[model samples]
Target chain A: MSKIKVENLTKVFGKQKKRALQLLKEGQTKKDILEKTGCTVGVNQANFTVEEGEIFVIMGLSGSGKSTLVRMLNRLIDPTSGSVFIDSEDISKVNDDQLRQIRRKTISMVFQRFALFPHRTVLENTAYGLEVQGIPKNKREDRAMETLQMVGLKGYEHQLPSQLSGGMQQRVGLARALTNDPDILLMDEAFSALDPLIRKDMQDELIELQSAMQKTIVFITHDLDEALRIGDRIALMKDGVIVQIGTPEEILTDPANEYVERFVEDVDWSKVLQAENVMKRAEMITLDKDGPRVALNRMRETGLSSLFAVDRRNRLQGVLSADAAKQAIDEGKPLADLIERDIVKVRPDTLLNDIMVQMAETNHPVAVVSDDDRVRGVIVRGSVIGALTGKEVKTHD
Target chain B: MTESIPKLPLADVVEVIVSWLQANVGWLFDFISNLIEPTVAFFTAVLMFLPTLVTIVLIAALTWWLSSWRIALFTLIGLMLIANLGYWEESAQTTALVLTATVISIIIGVPIGILCGKNDTARNIITPILDFMQTMPAFVYLVPAVIFFSLGTVPGVIASVVFSMPPTIRLTNLGIRQVPEDLIEASDAFGSTSSQKLFKIQLPLAKTTIMAGINQTIMLALSMVVIASMIGARGLGEAVLTAVQRIEVGTGFEAGLAIVIIAIVLDRLTQNLGQGNGQHPRN
Candidate 1:
């Protein structure tokens, strides 16, 4: 369900005419000439897939190629080398008319400047995109009215853009983009120009709209918090490369490299990562309610050996040691009685780093999982260590 | 005498210029006469199509509708007096000639203003030429115009348009550029083509300033009647010029009053239009 795929994208601006002339006289290869007077790559061989109905964010600082990358997706600025596919159809080879057709039908872009026509009334500005696609005036106006209402700008349609405040003007811009019913909406810092209070309001509005519409959105923002808040998955970009792309929790706790780690390190992890992310899946373990003798035998028999003691309700109790179980059997006690239920556990959704810190401070080998006093799984010290050192370890059930 | 020289006060310099102008007042009378001659002839020529009485009433009614009723009432009174004062027909013709010339000047002026407003190259080319036209005296504008198009209402119109057209062009350019950048960008992002951007954003936003420019142009054109009449153009300017030559102060005052009335009516109409809706400053 990849909605758009961009591959081997590159953008180079301006040829060195003087250098070319000098090189021609010296009979140097074009490669040598290019090497000597190199073109600045705005986007260097970028590759990514935008999934269907997902909010994909491209995050970067100024001049980090994220803006250029987004622009290339819609062919706002053509790439020097590469292809962009919308639903697996190559759009780069399309003629101008076809390109505009694609833009009119499939993609709509909202600019940082909120580019609404000033002379036209707000209604006219909203109806403009439909008008461009040759929708008749009365019908187009009806469409515009619907869109204006959708963006919460219904009554002031006759007023010029100059008559409204900046935030209201941006709302008009949003209405203009949505009027066409484009499949993929590309917002290039669309809210960055507004005041912080208005920016937050617009963000909430976008999220609310997204919930109902579920249109595939490719949002570009420099603010990490905005990316984390709005993005289903964020691609952290730096110096023309995607350093990492992941869910907010993965990016925060297990950043792919130093650049991404620095960006995520300062984030309030407890608030950003949800319970669903850190929750251990229940399929990893089997229930065993038999006494200490059978539990110890099961632990010794299993390879990469460990035993998770659980009750009939499938709630995690604690890990039972083979030696402790043997002594428990010698004392003639039940397995649940011998099993340590005082075990500290993290919820599945807790941040991996937060769990590591908790385990370090408690000096425990394992932490039990619980859902309303019912144990789910044990987060062992080995799992925490493996996550930290980028090691993949088999989960103990 | 050289060693003990004293400087004159600033008030003395102002007095010098004022006294010099007053002393040469007779020359001013002759200059006004030379400007009104052709305006009278043009009025006489257009009179065959419509009677003087009908023209006067129509013009008075137009003034009333376009401007305030008070100005219209005053204009009607002035026309009735001009008709009775033996200089009525001549004054009517002069009025027709001046109005025609002013309309034509506006027709040509606004588009040039729009062009300069929209393009840097056009502005750069036209700006210096307008500078010379504005800086040069009224009589200076008449020289080449008369040489090329003979002495008549046409040459008078040409000279008047030259002298009055610069403010319109310059103001229109200023107004267009003064439109907020965000509005212009908004137009662009909405996929408005270049032509749509201009008519929709640039022109509408610049409307007040453009109207203000046109207002100034009209005022300048009205001021040109006396000067244009000197080059054989007719109107109230001719009556004023002839009266002054005969030392008929009452006659001159009557014609001058008529000119002032017409100017007031036209000025108020343009001023009202410029200051109407869409002028609310961005809060």
Candidate 2:
């Protein structure tokens, strides 16, 4: 089931909220509504869902309402209209006490500024959410210590936040949120304050932690690259409305509008598009069923110098060149002897940029494999050049 | 021909209000005075009971604890000078009065300040009143204090508390209001109740500003010692008043020097205390 479902969530800020809502319903632009009613539209008709264990990113430029939308999920900013369902429960309708309970038990948030209490020690800050839940002091500390270790902050418990570096402080922030073991994590530009190197480290750490913990995370960022790197699905917002929501590849290759296309224009596609995006289905011979004669025939038919030899289950055995196949067929040798196992193999998710270097080192095409060693497709130099130069290569299944 | 502007009956208006309060809420005034009288008496008695040398030693030790030994040495020498001049007892009485007024002011001011900080209506109502309290001449409050408590140390303390409370309340409110918006949001996001946020986040982060407020209140209360003496309150102010009545320049100079000595000691001690609290290492 989807962990969070937000439907038609809208927030209007200022005195004439009802008028603003009316203007919004009347289909006036945010600027027009602001001029007409003197109220700013913070968020407008945002709708999206975060599936279980997915890293769903909400991204936009400053003043695009990405932060406002995230806040509305937890009801930190009460919506003028619409509802947010968490685990099928509409959090927008919960009373203050139930809201508090939900915030304590269901969702925890990390802030842009690493809003750790400057007065509290690292341990105290990390254990803050658990403390709010009234966990016993000893148990809370134990859980907090475990989380701290998970976030790579094992020895700095007694130190104050001021004493830690910016990266360390954010780790403490992450540790604080994780200490509660909540079902969903709402991270609002949590790494935006750190330097680039540190931000990258934190992003990598978050991805690692997400893999291990498998918690549904709704991450907010203004950085497109960060969204592409970490998000399972990304929602691009503009002017208080979500413009498009799709996977990183879909958002890059099939942007819904000119705005989205312009937003992604500067992105380095080679880093985003993977081997699966550029790989083509390869002609292959079954090693158990087909001999060297079949391999040679398939290579000639496909007009390829070499063909992959695979088992009956399509697990890659080796590559067989036409010369080796011909020698094997004349000598009456098994196809295994003719097969070459020295060719490079890569996973389907390997980035095109990474594959570029591997392709440069060898003169042969690279085979893309699934986790169970099944050959899915093969990436040739032409396909890599085609994808990098904006030619659409048929993506692998 | 000249046009005469109508005379404003501000003093008459004040006199009427004072009389009405005295008639209707006189028991409230009595109850407050009754409550504060023993605390004042207790502090005064303790100061009077301690020997001059012992009191000097204790104050010097407090100075040493709060600041450096250099300030403590100055305190020791200064107190000895007052003792030698035969003004030690008056200085003790003044210290007692200032301490009593400062304590009472903080107790009343801090909560009001916190309330003002949290609520817009309370802030709006209290801000103008605070402005009037701070800008009014210190002697004006003594009249109402004398009328309500009627000629004693209690009246002096009440007047001093009235004069000194505005800074504490104003600074406390400002301190809490100045707490970063992100921190408040973080606390709220974590599901902290209002009281928990106040105590844990707002109060702790506002400590330095509140300490500054306390320091200002202490200074203002000390400034009221001479004015408070007019209501028959005993202290070095009384000694100065007596010397002025007799026009004895030498006596006045000696009493005046003792008051100065007492002021320096109290100022240094309180300033050090505030600074000490402000500089508490992160924990």
Top lDDT hit: 2
CA lDDT of A38 in candidate 1? Answer: 71
Candidate 1 regions with alpha-carbon error over 4 angstroms: A1-52, A63-103, A117-121, A154-168, A195-198, A237-250, A254-262, A276-397, B1-107, B180-182, B243-254, B279-283
Where does the lowest 10-residue lDDT sum fall in candidate 2 chain B? B274-283
Model 1 chain A: lowest-lDDT 10 consecutive positions: A278-287
True contacts kept of each: 0.36, 0.59
Docking class of 2: medium
What is each model's TM-score for chain A? 0.69, 0.93
Instruction: For model 2 chain A, give the 10-residue run with minimal summed lDDT.
Output: A388-397
Candidate 1 TM-score over all chains jointly: 0.67
After superposing candidate 2 on the true structure, give the runs of residues whose Cα lies further than 4 Å from its correct spot: A287-300, A326-335, A395-397, B1-8, B281-283
Error of 2 at A249 (Å): 1.8
Please provide, for model 1 over B194-278, each residue's C-alpha lDDT reduced to its tens digit, 9 standing for 90 to 100.
Answer: 6766876788778889888888888888888888877777667777778878999887887887777667756876786666535
